[model samples]
Target: MSNNHNPAKPLQSILAIMAHPDDAEFCCGATVRQMSDAGADVTYIILTNGDKGNHNLSITVPELVKTRMKEQRAAAEILGVKDVIFMGEEDGFLQPNRELRRRLVRHIRKIKPDLIICQNPEMFFSGDRYINHPDHRNAGLVVIEAVFPAAGNPMFFPDLLAEGYEPHSIRELWICMAPEPDHKIDITDLLDVKIQALRQHESQFDDLDEMEKWVRERWSEENEAGEQRYYESFKRMKFD
Candidate 1:
């Protein structure tokens, strides 16, 4: 995340596709903030309504959905994201199915972002303590599938083309929480910005201070000379 080790450039536009409202914030908030600061028009696509994330039995599913959407918008605004699109897929039951892929293709074709940030489709589990969320894996798969063979191929969805969402292909792809990340971007300066964005999701956390502390300590690293740094790593791919 230091020096020329990074991409050394800012993109024209970025789209972060995630399984839930807070997923993008947790995975790539700081990176998105940096990109937006550098003048990238950033848009977020939350694939699920995030209705199931709350444990409060008093809150109904429909109410939670509306609340989460509001929180997501506030969070995205804080990060300078230009737009937030909620796919409204049921939480926890997302699948990498044809319907979703086609829908994603339509969105991708319309957004026409040069860079896309997504989660890891192949990750079924993480460390010994956690099993990766099904929605996360499925969301990644849906994005990748749409980006490939679909969004760029007019034949995949002829209706989309007729509707004027002409075939569009992204120039670069970045996967967060990838098993093997080859690149890291320094986000040491946007730590506060990231925290503020995450804070917008008020219904997700019971203890805000504790959550903030965890986030700070999670990505912080110190060099030999006591210089602390933070980063967001990604698996990057480019197309000619």
Candidate 2:
């Protein structure tokens, strides 16, 4: 776990691992913008193509995948992200397995990000109102495993080491939408950037205005007990 209690310290690099194209934008776009704006290198790892994102049965998976990939690139550019890597996995069917962990470990080694951000793996259900996507939970668990023993231990992924990717130890892991968040980043100044980034994913939303409003209200609710105007909260786990 991390020894640093101060959340304001600037991290040199940040990597966001998410299940779909717009997950990063919806969860932590402002945070990514803030970090990148502060001169930190930011990268995105999208584990799925988001082909099954559209509810309309008429839309084909290949078409949706291409559109989602394009939107992801645009969104990443808007957030000042240095790179957006797609794992080419089928949407809605991600699994936490050795192959997935090995792939994630390779990226962890290659990126060597100081901070790794992802979804909450344990958030399966939310008060009957919503059910967390299986892909999101799987991606979270995969990243958590990859960041720990797989990425840091040289023996875990021997092929990666042989391929010239060195073991990289992450300083912190940040899980978004966690049940208990220990860190909150005030993102009032970057809210507009986040909204704009989300707008890039036009294929997913029927009404962008409503989407933006819901996001704003959600984040605002997180700040009702704090002094921060608009905030993004995360469960921070520090590792040596």
Best by lDDT: 1
Top model number, TM-score? 1
C-alpha lDDT of all candidate models, in order = 0.90, 0.89
Which regions in candidate 2 have their CA more than 4 angstroms from the true location?
A: 1-9, 222-228
> Model 1, 193: alpha-carbon shift in Å?
0.8
> What local lDDT does model 2 show for residue 206?
94
If scored against the real structure, what TM-score would every candidate get?
A: 0.94, 0.93
For residues 147-189, write the lDDT of model 1, one tens digit per residue: 9989999899898899999999998999999888887877888
Evaluated against the true structure, the overall lDDT of model 1 is: 0.90
Cα distance off (Å), candidate 2, residue 137: 0.7
lDDT of 2 by residue, 9-38 (tens): 658899999999999998889999888877
